[model samples]
Target: METSFKIAFISGKLGDVDGVSLEVDKWIEVLTGAGHEVFTIAGLYTNPLQSISSDKQFSLEYLRFDSTLQHHYEKMMFPYLTKHPTHLTSGTRDIIVEEMMVHGKELSEDIFQIIQDNNIDVIIAQNTNAMPMTLLGGIAVYNLLSEYKVATIFHHHDFWWERSRFSQNRIEGLLNKIMPPSDIGSEHVVISSYSAHILSSIKRVIPTVIPNCENFGKAAVLDNYNSHFRSDLGFDKTDILFVQPTRIVPRKRIEDSVRLVGMYGRKYPEIKEKIKFIISLYQGDELDDSYIEVIKNLAKSEDVDLHLISDRVSSVRILNNNGERLYTSRDVLVNADLAIYMPKWEGFGNAFLEAVSCRVPVVVSTYLVYKTDIKSAGFDNLEVRDNYDDEGLLKIPESILIDMHQILNDSEKRIQMTDKNFEIGKREFGFKMLSEKLNTLLDSYSDEIRASRRRLQKSKKSYAV
Candidate 1:
């Protein structure tokens, strides 16, 4: 019989306009290409409007988590928990446990039934185990995995420990149980060496490092895109598009991007009217209204041509009722003159990878992850430090503009840089590179399965005899 594993890629929200959604879609492409049927078990979805048909061998069930309900529970309960390095009191712990059990029972039942009904061989629990966005969802997945002994691959993108928002919560005990279980019949995957090392050190769980990869082999053709996109956005053909392909979050440091462009525009009077700094995503995490206002004030003061185009962009391409084609984020990257990725923290920095894949020169900030891990790998780009004084800011953009002019002027130099970056990326973050590591992991997983099955058989025989 032909052996094809039925894989359920589970997440909090699978089909949204976010990095996680983009990453999951890429994995589906890889999994489906490898001949495994891919399905999504998500809180929300924005792609492939129809669920997996019953006639098809694969299936995905949507376990919708009500955002309003989650918000209510969090507001009602989270305040009483310890903040910033959250340790819980006995009273709060009891309440958290009660809620986990209540939601876990229903979640576990549904998951178990789905597994049995579909003969699911394994589950790729994406970030749900790492992030406590849905505490009950984690509990449910944890309970089902333990009771059924199902093979699970917990693909951790970011851990709750890495974020400040989850610093103090009443769910520490539950988070410990599920935020990646450290036992034999399962495997774990982390996106970066930094995460892998930290998780192993903290939880004593060895996880395989699978860096997020991009497909650069397929060239990004820019035929009608430039003209069409320019016309759509009301930009002239001569306009210099400086794209900040990230959300308007505090951590993203979008003000720096606006400043970068504004400084450039001011320094180069010849291109003053042509520079446009476009932020492609909507406002994020309303907790930091001050930072949002800072970006606005900075842009206004610097005379930056800022465009927040969140309303127009989405994860998937679609034609509206009026026959307007909505473009994906990839389209934005393809047409960008330069890409800015100046985030304070990133697990793997997929935006950097995307920029390189698009063959665009980038201006990056020296984020901790990049400084410690990526710099040593020998990938070269126009980069700067975090702190930017007035003089320093003025100098940095001038240098970048000169570099972009050179990159545009010198075809040989541009090719050399792109080629070198591409090779380095392929060595580290290419799909095939990850696939090789995954293949070995799968070998180990198969051995684990065989050993487990034999042990169960021996126990059964011994009891029978």
Candidate 2:
């Protein structure tokens, strides 16, 4: 008989524009396309049911970041954010651990029930074991996996050690254990080679590296639905749209984009009014309102036309609750003239691939992962060194500004560059690669399952004798 497994994707939140959510969506597409039955279990759903049917979707309130218990625990764990206690007392720490165990046990039962009801063959835990955003969820998943023999793949995008905020946490032991259990009957998948190396060094486990990919076969195009994207965002046909297709976060280095745009405006005063640097996504993951304020202040000083259109963008194209026509990031990308992706750090650049898929030219920084994993792919981006000036702004080179001007004004040059990028992106980070990798994983999992079953049957016969 032909082999196919029913897979479940479990995460804190899915169906959103965040890197984890977006990448999970792509995996779901590939999995379902390959005739595998796929289901999603998330703490929250940011969009209406479209990818997965409502019946196949499961939502657990306790798994959400803003759940009563989660929020309380977060404040306690990262007390620097709350500004009350600098550290947790040993007694208080023990109490929190006890509570987590109790709550995790309850959550494990619920998750196991879902597995039993669905007959799920594989569970793809998306970032649940990597980040501490959903601590209890990670604990519960660990509990469930420890008690059961379910085939699992822990898809870790970012680890807790990578972020500074999670550094001074009170739950060190809990994080070391459940955040990513050292010994589990499952495979581990990291998005970049850097992550794989880090995991190997820290946890003594080798992981499969699966970089983020895009559907290059179906590239974004300016359709009737998305044609009005520019006008709706109050831009003219002649306007130069420089899109920062990422969240308003410090790590994204959005301030660099503002500074680059400011330089372009100063260099060419005639086209200054027509230049629009729009950030296409919302403030997400990292909570820093001060960073938004800093960007606004920097833009004002540089005389750059900055616009935040996240309110009108989502994972899917539909009317929001306010009846406003929402555009996906692709809608924003297809209409953009240039994309600014100057991140200080990234697990894997999803927005970079999105821009490449949309046939948009980009100005990218040479972050560590990009230097190691993505840059050698032979992409023709206007490269910026990941260096900072005394003013804490990303140093913009004169050549980058000149190249930006040429690409923006010269239509033939722009087309040639974007077309070349699209071909390279498709060749390197396409959906075909993802499909092939998934096939190999599934095949190995099937073999392992069969061997275990045979062992169980042999043991039963021996017991009877």
Candidate 3:
């Protein structure tokens, strides 16, 4: 690894409850630890960047997508963006193509400024290039990388081809150019094998798999965290803690967690009142606000002890003036009796991986990534399908109790499961493993650039003679 290079991480929104933001932060930790300078440029960021750098690190010159002409382009193309096979009238398709041509030029300029200002030796573009949510953002990145000989690693979390929202767009020209590893001087990296396979089918670019992982500090539980955590949250030590460490987003299908808890209470009447389902984060309907209302109604009707603790927890641990010690997401995971992760769709389930890493049993939905990638790694848990399974809903909490008893009563079983998972996670998602893959990709890019420069120098010398 070249320790002296300045690496820049670019994203549409690099901070918040989203998976991309969380994964980017983990990359920052790994990359910075290896002695490379790191910078962030995003439309949104909640993390403090004082440690990253004061001068070189920059945020979006314009933060909102609605501000740019790109938003209007996507808005007008929505009718043609549907995945269902339908013939768009020629007039509509022509209008959409014309708009794309105009926005493409404006987008190119934004990207050029970001690259020049940061003096970015290499770019780690996070998910923006993969998903066309900001279509012009993808176009901008593609244009800049194609023109400048900058080394880039497109950290693809989800591809436009996977999602239905983008499948029918009339702008195939733009999508083909911007999506994945095509038409850009970049290496492609997907978070799971399934994404890598799908990307390979759509684009000639075969993505390197660099799955997500929890940080070093997140692995071990703090010794006294639970005592203070319970006290602060007004729960007794014996309260059954069911933690859902994800945002309140519709795709997350959080109602499933409520149903799981309610069904568990009905089956195991003994621990009914003792169970507390805590949602440790919030994502307030940034896309569509209706889902938030639906979740609130579901929580209320189910009578589940659901707590949204976003206000209480920060990225760093601190104490309030009243001497109440605040906690991070790690502290919540450390104290959890069981972690419910039932996302209907996920790029990869980082929460499930973190739960197993922290020695907590998990109740996970069999999302594509888990079914194909994580499940094969030997994770045993309550696995549900896309929708609620009546049997799983009724039996999973009891399963948690059985596992809890084994963890507390049988030392050997606990050790076997935890040690097995740790080994599996390290093999698949550990820092040591991922860093080796990352540096290998960067080295190949470095070699190509060096070769091109040498050839250019030789040509100039011959001309002079």
Candidate 4:
């Protein structure tokens, strides 16, 4: 009979710069604002918690990506990282599957305890069933949902099949069963229409599309604390700061950003020396240091002043143990002259929304989701074709370079373009839109629960007669 419900958000990691973490934060904000009790359960916490109380937060070590069980299964399933044999023997495969069941059961028990303690009414599994980053975690959630009648919503951002690295795995059977189990009595949510179409084709179940949203009401500005971001990051006052606010992952195609800057420098040699390309976020979710090296070498060859300042960036501003100031991602965006977001693929563009919300001009690649779901929103940005050259770098259009030059050099043009973009972005992807969609989804679930209870009562009375 209660109007509000206690909700629990479960994920592999939370309070970080990744798209999933940022989206989860926005969901928590909207849910709490709607008078619902929210709780967080994550395997790892990279940043401090802001919205959820400490008493309501739960951390499980076995569910972490770096846990011994996860590493063991990953190496066995996807053996590209290590020198181990690519194909597992049938007997060895069976043993690994048995171990998975054992560990998964333990994890499910632990998770159920938290659910019972908090009297949670719904569980929002954040990317757990979509990606195999934490294999046991996915199985555990599936098992928990199978044994109990706890309402759930699988908020899938990306699926394992989308990534080439997870394509040739030895655990196909297990992945098919629990990576995203179709039989679970829960709602499904995807970030884009493309993802929803794909999920329907694969799982035969239609998903509700919920595009990622931003808090446009509290736009970042050049405040007193963030005014010194440039000086603190060692950038000269006259330098043109072009920020790549994404992780150093392969799909991001950061080399393309470096190449664009290099081409822009050649076109206008006068300002080449004053250009600074800054990659604000850290390396990606996967284990790959060679890609960072590749970017560094390419930057050197292109003669770009590339700076990796992830050490001083966090979800929120704080001081490190060494007494150095750590700036939030908003601080990096507020001071940027232009944002370069040329990812080859993205579930949805969180960095794009962040830049637009901050009133910064963006140079975005026309990725699939961008073309399908976002471009029609009428945001004015310097667009790059997603086509690539034989060298595996994005093909930068000449017109993009010309537009970039104008936006970077002319103050009035920059202000007009960015202001227009901010209004369009806020109108399309603001918190109010998300809050409305979420409320509707929750209301439907509440109706289903009442219908289910009525059916149970009718069946019990007939059986007693």
Candidate 3, run of 10 with poorest lDDT: 392-401
- lDDT: worst 10-residue window of model 1: 54-63
Give lDDT tens digits, candidate 2, residues 109-165: 788678766767778899999998888789878876676555678999999988888
Model 2 lDDT on a 0 to 1 scale:
0.87
Query: Comparing 1 and 4 by TM-score, which wins?
Result: 4
Tens digit of per-residue lDDT, candidate 4, span 224-317: 8888888987888889999999899989889999999889988989999999999999985875799999999999999999999999899988
Off by over 4 Å in 2: 449-465
Better of 3 and 4 by lDDT: 4
Worst 10 residues of 4 by lDDT: 451-460
Expressed as tens digits, the lDDT of each residue in 1-465 for candidate 3 is 333556778777764546777677777877788777788777655655434665655665333344455555655565543234455687977876776655654655665555555555777788768777666666666755676555677898877766666675767666776776485456888888988888878787877888887654447675766447888888888888889988777778788788777777676677789988899877732354677687778888887777888776655566767776777776788788778898878888877777777777677878878888888877667566554466533224456545544564476876677677777776777777767876777676776544434443454456554
Residue 261 error for model 1, in Å?
1.5
Backbone collisions counted per model = 0, 0, 0, 0
For model 2, where is the 10-residue window of minimal lDDT? Answer: 451-460
Best by lDDT: 4
In model 4, the clashing pairs are: none
- Candidates 1 and 3 compared: the better one by TM-score is 1
Pairs that collide, model 2: none
TM-scores vs. true structure, each candidate: 0.86, 0.95, 0.82, 0.95
